[model samples]
Target: MIRRTFPILGVLTAVLLSYGLYEALIGAPTEQSMGDVQRIFYYHAPSAWTAFLLFGINFVASVVYLIQRSIKADIIALVTAEVGVVFCTVVLVTGPIWARPVWGIWWTWDIRLTSTLVLWLIYVSYLILRRFSSSGQTPLMAAVIAIFGALDVPLVYFSIRFFRTQHPQPVIGGEGSIDPKMLQVALINWAGFLCFACLVCWSRYRLELLQREVEETEALEALLDSRKAQ
Candidate 1:
């Protein structure tokens, strides 16, 4: 039953996400200041939020994997980290696209922007580390890296406070206020992206499981061949 339900849930979520995108692009009101280009916010902000959420999941799963020595937790952490990297790339790319129109530049060295760049690099390095690290060493090394890397998230969030920033503060959640119509679209976009993130993570996790099973099968076959030769 659980197996059957997942596909149905994925289809429903995809449908809602499609509707949200249409509402974001067509139904939402345009910003007076940035005009049509401002519509990118629907995608960009949600991508950033999803990246953060994925990284958080990776951190928690890493902790559990360390404590429980569960392969499932490690697989979930690995899958979430990969998904997080993809969303982080989306956020970084789309940010500049939005900024080029609004800030008159393709890139900025503002605190938030710089810190986010660093955070992306850190996670990318984490992925590379996992690739090179020995299989037996993976869980401990990955858990440590996850803990250390996640600390950057809070720094990225508060970077503007300690340093100068050309980037604008979050209008929806922070002290600044946003237009009602903009807020509505932003919220819907966020929901859509969150659901999409889960879908991607689940798919990646399943793929990892399949890959592990294949490796185990290969190992067992090699052992049996050795025994037969003896």
Candidate 2:
């Protein structure tokens, strides 16, 4: 079931993403103020949303693993954080691409931008601890850190509202209104990205499961070898 479903999901995601790219790059009308560069919104906005969504999943899995000490939950938390970080990287990269033209600067310490960088760094550190640390309690420690990192998501989201920044206002809610056509394009693009993120995340989870299984089998064999020597 997993084999059959996963490929289907991947194929569907690819198809959706193909059309979404056209919609974003060509179908959407250029913004009056920002012109063609604003088209980055189609990609940038969806990336940010998907990153937050995946991180939210990471948060839930972290909580579940902490509560049940389930290895499956740990796999979920790890993979989602990895995939979420990838999308977050996309957000960080695209933000500067968009900003360079509009803000005339490639980077700034604006509240929203700074908070997002911090968010990305926190997750990157979590991944480092998981990979490099030899602690038996790594998963538990990472889960605790994930909970705190998850708290930052809300802060990143609200930073534009809570403080003044060079970052643009929220597209979903503000005094400004998006054109109906552009809104549709954005929605379609977002759906495509959501599907794509799910596909990549599912693949990563499966790979992690296999890796974990191999490690346990190797450990078992090593134990038996020691016992025979004894």
Question: Could you tell me every candidate's TM-score relative to the true structure?
Answer: 0.89, 0.89
Model 1 pairs in collision: none
Scored by CA lDDT, what does every candidate get? 0.83, 0.85
- Error (Å) of candidate 1 at residue 63 is 1.1
Lowest lDDT 10-residue stretch of candidate 1: 166-175
| Model 2 Cα lDDT, one tens digit per residue, 56-137 | 8889999999999998999889988998899999999999998888878888666667777888999999999898867578
Q: How close to the true structure is residue 114 of candidate 1, measured as C-alpha lDDT?
A: 76
Off by over 4 Å in 1: 152-161, 165-175
CA deviation > 4 Å runs, candidate 2: 152-175
Model 2 residue 32 CA deviation (Å) reads 1.6
How many residue pairs clash in all the candidates, one count each?
0, 0
* lDDT by residue (tens digit), candidate 1, 1-230: 86996787688778878888888889898877789998888888888888888888899999998899899999989988899999999989998898887777888667667777888998999999999999878878988899888876677767655655455543222325688888888888888788777887777888889998999999999999999999
